[model samples]
Target: MRVEQQPGFVLHARPYRETSLLVECLTRDHGRIGVVARGVRNERARLQRAQLEPFQRLELDLLLKGELATLRGAEPSGAVMRLTGDAGLAGLYLNELVVRLTGRQDPNPDLFAHYERTLRRMAGGEPLAWTLRRFERDMLDALGYALQLDIDANSGEPLDPSIRYVYDPESGASPGRPGDPHGLRGADLLALAEDRSPDVAGLSSLRRMMRQVIAFHLGGGELRAWRVLR
Candidate 1:
């Protein structure tokens, strides 16, 4: 398969052989792809190396034969989002998630759009927690495991804001007993569902819940970005 001028972003890259690089890119129309960039690490290929950095929008040319595609050409399609500090680390985490969760060559335009927006928001100084939570919510939806935030899974009743709930990875929110350490406030979940900002405590609760859910989906594979960020 040959693709030309595909809009994409490099999720991760690592040195391969003597002067080549192995790249994973997420594209608007082609989900995720594994590519080999020959001679990208050569002394004279600084420009190619720079264009392959994460968070940069690229127009890629590819030739796919088998499992990995050969990166024929890459050029900047737009300005790169300048992410720094924890936001930079968070950006890596997002890339790792897409690489781990998404199937190669599978198309999910919605997730791609959410990822693009999330990165731009992070770079624009939006609250990291809120942006990440939104991405996680949308990511799960794209993966067909959307969280049930408004209703209690066990009782099949609408969640009461006053009540506390424990999120089940498989089923979603259920009423939690008083003093349960893992309990998340129903209000917090509701606020997240509606894309409303919650208090610091609620944000923390959502973070924990999302981590748990994402972990469950990973099926025991650890996210290295979590280690770096933490």
Candidate 2:
């Protein structure tokens, strides 16, 4: 197969054998891909060393054969935003989420653009909570699991901002049920879905709600970076 260049971001990478790496990348045109970079651990392997850092933009050349491709060439297309402090941790969290949720060999250009924009925003020191919430919502939507926030899932009517509601992972938002596992105030839910800054209390409650939703979808595996943030 011929080698072809694709713009991508390194989502995850781990040392392979003695000198190579097994890398997972998210690309604009090709979505997620797995490639093996031979001899990337060598100090003299300049090209491989430079292109393997997470969050950096890269132009990668890979063989088009097999499910796992062989890396032919890689170069930095541009500098990546350097996130620090809480923002940095949040960036890692986002990367982990993408790695978990996105499928290999699937094209999701719109999600890729969102990921790029989100990285820039996080690097600029936006509130990590808000940034993560937005990204989670968008990623779910892109993956076809969009939550129904604008209307009641059971009643089929517009959400009543004045009334409390509960988010059921399987059925979306509905009026608060007495024995539900998780619930949120209508105002907080509305504010979160609308990307508005709710009060601290509301924001805290919304985080819990979103977390339950995310965890349910993730099949109960804890997010390691979130633990760091907490």
Each model's lDDT comes to 0.90, 0.81
**How would you encode candidate 2's per-residue C-alpha lDDT over 92-195 as one tens digit per residue?**
88888888877798999888988988898888877777777778778888888887777889888888887778888798788876655466777777776787
Q: How many residue pairs clash in all the candidates, one count each?
A: 0, 0
Q: What is the lDDT of residue 81 in candidate 2?
A: 81
Worst 10 residues of 1 by lDDT: 42-51
- lDDT of candidate 1 over 139-198, digit per residue (tens): 999878888999889888989999999999999899889999899999999999998989
- lDDT of model number 1: 0.90
Model 1, backbone clash pairs (residues 3+ apart or across chains), number: 0
TM-score of 2: 0.91
